[model samples]
Each structure stands twice: as C-alpha cells, then as structure tokens.
Target: MFSLLRSATAFLIATASLAQGYSNPGACSGACWAHDPSIIQRTSDNLYFKFNTGSGIEIATASSLSGPWTLTGYALPSGSKIDLAGNTDLWAPDVHKVGDLYYMYYAVSTSGSQTSAIGLATSSTMDVGSWTDLGATGVASSPSKVYNAIDPNLIAVGSSYYLNFGSFWHDIYQVQMSSDAKTPSGTSVNIEYDATGTHPCEGSYMFYYSGYYYLLWSHGICCGYDTTKPATGDEYKIMMCRSTSATGGFVDQSGVACTSSGGTTLLASHGTTYGPGVFTDSSKGLVLYYHYADTDVGLGDGSYLFGWNVLGWSNGWPTV
Candidate 1:
C-alpha cells in the first residue's frame, strides 16, 4: 500500500508539471463548435464576439467570457472575393477594433495546398451585413513560395501595427502595417520557425502583458477533427515565447531563440481538449480558448466542443 501511494504521488506530480501554468476551466456549450477562433470585446455594449474558421467565417456572440454563446451569423455570407482559393471555407481569423471601425484578418487557402492569401474586411458594427471586404492584402503564397500565407494576426503596439502570418512551409512571419491596419508597408520578417516536423507552428497570436510581448502559437498537426489525431502526441499544442520587442528576438523559457525550434509548451492535449487559441477576455482576464473531443459527446463524430480557461501569471509568464 505504501509503495502504491508513492507511485500515485509521483504520477500526480508529473501530471502537474506537464500542465505548466494552465488549467481547463470547462467545456463551453450551445453553439460552441469553433476552430481557429479569435475573440474581441466590443466597447459599445461590452458584448464579446468570437470569429472562427468556417464556410463564411462563423461568428459567435456572448455577454461574458463564461459564455452561453449563440451563433448569430457569418461575417461574409456570400464568401470572399478570393473565393476560388478559399472556396467557401475560410481558416484562422484574427479580429481587432481600430478606432471606430473593426478590422478582421482571415486566411484563404485551397485546402491542403500552400496556395493561400490573407484578406482584410472591415465593419462599423460587428453585425452580419456591416462588414466590407477590402480584398487581399497583397500577401499571398504560391507553389514556388517558401512561406504559406495563412493564419493572419494583427498585433498593435503603441502607434505601430504589425501583421503576423504564415504556416507550414516556414512557420510564422510578420510585417509592419500601415496606420489603416489594412496594408502591409515595410519588409516582412521571419518571426518563428521550427526546423522539424511536418508543420511546426501556425496560428500566431501576440499579446503584450506586463513588459514582455508573449508570442503564442499552435504547433503540430491540426484539423483532423476526430477521424485522426497526432500519433506523436504533439498535435494542436499551444507553444509560447517572449521578447521585449514586438518584432523579433522572442525566446522560450530556456532562453532558446524562437527562430530556432525552441518554444515552451504552454498547453497541450489535456484529456480531450486541443488546438488552443489564447486571447484576452475583458471580464475573465487572459483566456485560453480551444477545441476538445468530448468522449461523452461522441468522439469520432467530429463533435469537438469549445474549451476554455482563465490564464494566470507566474514570474511574468502566462499560466492556465
């Protein structure tokens, strides 16, 4: 009995260490089907809105972070002008409000191919018919391109703005944006890359907390739903790095550069949850929202529920 107790204690300690600083808050119900979700809180009425990858870029609204979310409508019902590449299915959206207008950056790609383009759309109000598609941002990927132009995220630091994007081929890249937040101005710079794996990292979201710019991204195979999962047990994990400057010099906890294959695992396949997207929740502080295959809800049927957790800070790093 004593030996068994010691073994169990050791197992618990190991599990705790693997979790890092995050804890699963619970599953979100009612219109929770979301992948590559980007969240923003509207200041007009303080309502929370989440945009996701889907046919027309799915939109979900809630009053609070702990949501009784409802799928109201899609940002683009008629699909984007670049509908040939994205078809009706778009991927990985990043939404941010600039001044009185809201800007949404989304990925348009031909399924598995790297032929992709990042497009811009704007809305005065985040309603269904309010959004106006501004066409592509001139950032695109071709067969000869080394970087995949998808998963666009706009990071605003002070007066300057940067659009961070890329996937698969070379991972993440960033470029300084015009004041309008729609056009890329300066030269695009490589931000993060993993020299190993099929698709090392994607879905880059940069958050400025305390004095550091924390770069959070998803690593490993994503979007198998329930039909497939990562055999290496590394799929859809949230990886993180930090730097004082928003542009470059990001490093993991071990002081390893992000330009290398260095990233500290922030969240991984804990139980059924996977594919975490970190965002700031106005009411709940820092929140990590992801998708999970709930065994209780029938696993292999592609019924991945929404999963979320409030992140805590320890030693200037984010914890769940």
Candidate 2:
C-alpha cells in the first residue's frame, strides 16, 4: 500500500508540472485588452487586423501579430440594424475575406439570454469608416428556440461556405450560406455539444488544415467571473474535434464523437493565464490567437487581454 501511494503521488506531481509549462502569450502593447478576438491578416498589405466583441464590434490593427495594437474604431458605428430589446453591445466578430471584399459576422444579444441574432457587415478596407452593416443573416434565436445563436464563425470549404454559431442551449450548430454570403441557405445542423455540467460551449471556429476540417470552440463559463464563476479548471478553455468533411463526422483525438459529448482539450488555464478562449490563425505560421484573463490581474471580464502563441503539430494533432 505504501509503495502504491508513493507512485500515485509522484505521477500527480509530474502531471501538474507538465501542465504549468504552457508558454505565456507573446508580448503585446497598446489596446492589449480584447474579448472574443478574431484575428486575420490582409493579403493586400500583410497588415494584421483583429476584431473583438464590443459596441459595434471593436476594430484594432497592428503591423505584427505581437504588437503595438491601436484601437481604430467600431465596424458599425451606429450599432446593428437588427434591434433586440436591451441589446446595446455586439458580441463575437468573425471576419474573413471572400473575393475582393471582407465580410464580418457578429452577434446581437443581451447577456445570458437566449434572445439573440447574428448580424453581418462588409468592408473593402476593413477600416472603421469603410464597413457597411448588412443587418441580420437570418440566423437567430429566442427564448422559445432550441439553440442560442451567438459566436458567429464562417468557413469556406471548396465552393461551399458554412456559418457555425451557438451557445448554452444546443451548444454549436452549422448552416450553409448562400453564394452572396448574406444569409443561411439551408437548415442548421447541430455539430457539437457538451452534456457535462452546464453544457457550456460557444465561440466555434472552423478551419481546414492538411486534409481534415478542424472545429474548435471555447467550453465552460466565459463571463460572470466575480459572482457565478465555475470551479477551478472549469472556466473557459479551448476544445477541439476534427473531421474529414467540413459539415460533420467530427471526432476527438480519442475517437469520441463530438456530437456525443466528446471533445479534446486544446488549451486551458495554466500558469498566470485563465480562460483561454476563441481562436484565429494568422499568416505567421500556425499561430493560435485568443483572449484570456491574467490571474495576476484577477479573473474577470474587465481584465481580459489579447493572447497568442505559435503552435506545433505532433502526429496529427496540434500541440502548444
């Protein structure tokens, strides 16, 4: 019994030490604060642009990924055209360039409520004054709806484009987009869910890597850090599943189906960082960019900061 106890203790210590080795985010300055950040680099000038959840989807730009970022202005200076009662702020901006124009999809909703709508906007330069709000994308939810439509993510596979968004209720869902990319073209398909605990999952981002389509999302409680905060290691963390097809058949590294409550954790709280959520790839290698609360700054929405680190791959999975 003594020998077995010593072995278990040694294994636990080794595991904890390994978890603490996650690299800190690369240095950043100027407008470092961001929440639910979506980063993309323009092919035209190679300039980096990051959009975050805020009033009218806050816009910031930097010459480099790890940067002296400057907050330019909001994408929709007048707020979303699709008005919901008591919704003053836009949440979760996902930006992508199709053809010569850039399209940004955002969410309009109040906190913790199922009443939400996903809005779309476009720009030629991605600058503050260039964006034109195109209103709702026809993907929305009410208290009566089965899914909460927030955290909009757009991905193009071959000739088809799909929008993935959801929260709380049914976790994550994907819908095919019309050619013009203005609204949903088909029925929404439920892709991923977490049956564990409160079923907290959102911020879905789909990206094609190698030959597989990877779906990554933030799982667990994201906000309300001061009050209804989740237990330690249960706050927001990045999780992932992959599939050969873009629409479905996603599975975790352990071969567990994502729809059946299976997800492989990609990043979680470690060292001074907590609640690493959201992800976007930059031109500089396979860089994983996100927003996290610094433990030193206190865990809360107000202390959220932009974070990033380049990633490496082992076998077929991504490693931090």
Candidate of highest lDDT: 2
Candidates' TM-scores? 0.89, 0.91
The weakest ten consecutive residues by lDDT in model 2 span 1-10
Can you tell me which runs of candidate 1 are displaced by over 4 Å?
A: 1-22, 298-301
Best by TM-score: 2
Candidate 1 all-Cα RMSD:
7.9
Off by over 4 Å in 2: 1-20, 277-283
The total number of steric clashes, by the backbone 3 Å criterion, in model 1 comes to: 4
Clashing pairs in 2: none
lDDT at position 78, candidate 1: 78
Cα error, residue 206 of model 2, in Å, equals: 0.7
lDDT of every model, 2 decimals: 0.71, 0.76
Query: Cα RMSD (Å) per model?
Result: 7.9, 8.2
Question: Candidate 2's residue-wise lDDT over 52-79, tens digit each?
Answer: 7878778899999778999998888788
Candidate 1 TM-score, true structure as reference: 0.89
TM-score (C-alpha) between model 2 and the true structure: 0.91
